[model samples]
Target: MKLLLDENLSWRMVNKLGVVFPEVVHVTSLNISQPASDISIWDFAKKNGYTIVSKDDDFEKIVLLRKAPPKLLFLKTYNLNTEKLVNLIIANNIKIKEFINSDENDIFEIFGE
Candidate 1:
């Protein structure tokens, strides 16, 4: 599945993660300017079928409160470092796939080691 990285993620992380996530795009990559509103981004993803990968808790609310698609990878980890985040994604990718396929919606929160 593809990952649409949020504005919170550095654009460099997309390149750095390489094959970990098949396709990862930052908001800037989409040519959207900075300070894009949460709802707008979510709306874009919903309309376009891009599952979100973000550090923001707002997506969780969107999932729980709004039940939007495709689902969300909510990085709650505090490290906020590139390598750490990449490792978490690599480790949890299988679970992520299950989330995308199963009937239930998911919230994947990475706790920093």
Candidate 2:
């Protein structure tokens, strides 16, 4: 599954995650206007078949109201650097993939253990 990473995440993650998630992209790369709104990102994800991966709970709220198609991965880990964040994702890769494939859930939350 492709990930449309939110602006909250470092754009550097795009390349770092590229090997594992080739289609992963950051909001900055999309040429979205500065301070892109959550709605706009949601629209882009809905149109592009990209799941929104973010630290923002707003997207989670959106998923709760809108239902599927633009799924969400909500990273709830605390005070992690970009590398640590990426590592966390790698560690939970299997769960993320399973969540993407499942039809029952729209939002997947990842927390540091």
Candidate 3:
């Protein structure tokens, strides 16, 4: 599945994670305005078939309120360096795939182990 990384995440992650997630992209790479609104990002992802990867709770709130077209991968950990964060996501790749493929769920929460 395609993944649209949220602003809270580093744009550098696109290349790093691209090996496993070929369609991964950071929000900055898109044509949208810098500091895009959560709703705008959500709309973009919905239209483009991207599952949002974010550390922000705002996306979760949006999904709860509006339901999902663009799914969510919510990072519950904090204070992790880029490498650590990348590793966390990579290690959980299978779970991510499962979440993306599941028809019943829209949000997947990832906690640092």
Candidate 4:
């Protein structure tokens, strides 16, 4: 599944995982750095068929309410650097993708562990 990563995540994380997740993209790269509201981001994700991979719980709430192509994966913890975050994703890729594909209507949370 394609992922629309939030600006809260470092761009380098997307760069490093480019090979692993070929379609991973950041909001900055989408030229959405002009401070659009969260609703705008949700609209963008909905129109683009991209699931929201964000550090924001609002996205999770949006998914819980709206329920569709705008699926969410909310990263709960803070203070993680790019490398650690990359490792966490890599370690969990298969299971994560399986779950993502298994249910696009579900909202998921990933905590640093």
Q: Each model's C-alpha lDDT?
A: 0.76, 0.90, 0.93, 0.77
lDDT head-to-head 3 vs 4, winner: 3
Off by over 4 Å in 4: 31-33
All candidates' TM-scores? 0.86, 0.94, 0.97, 0.87
The reply for model 3, stretches above 4 Å from the true place, is none
Model 2 ranges off by over 4 Å: none
- Please write out the lDDT profile of model 4 over residues 1-113, one tens digit for every residue: 67888878787788777777888888877756456567887888889878777888877777778886677878776878888888878777786687678754477777894
Report the C-alpha lDDT of model 3 over 73-110, residue by residue, as the tens digit: 99998878788889999999999999999988989999
Alpha carbon deviation, residue 74, candidate 3 (Å): 0.2
lDDT by residue for model 1 over 5-106, one digit each (tens)? Answer: 888887777876657666677777674556777787888777877788888887788788888585788888876578788878888888877776676655
Q: How far in Å is the alpha carbon of 50 misplaced in model 3?
A: 0.1
The candidate, 1 or 2, that scores higher on TM-score is 2
List all candidate RMSDs to the true structure: 1.7, 1.1, 0.9, 1.8
Q: 2 or 4: which has the higher lDDT?
A: 2
Clashes by residue pair, model 2 = none
Please report the candidate that would top lDDT against the real structure.
3
CA displacement after TM-score superposition, residue 54 of candidate 3 (Å): 0.3
* Cα lDDT of model 2 by residue, 23-79, tens digit: 999998886776899999999999999989999999988999998889999999877
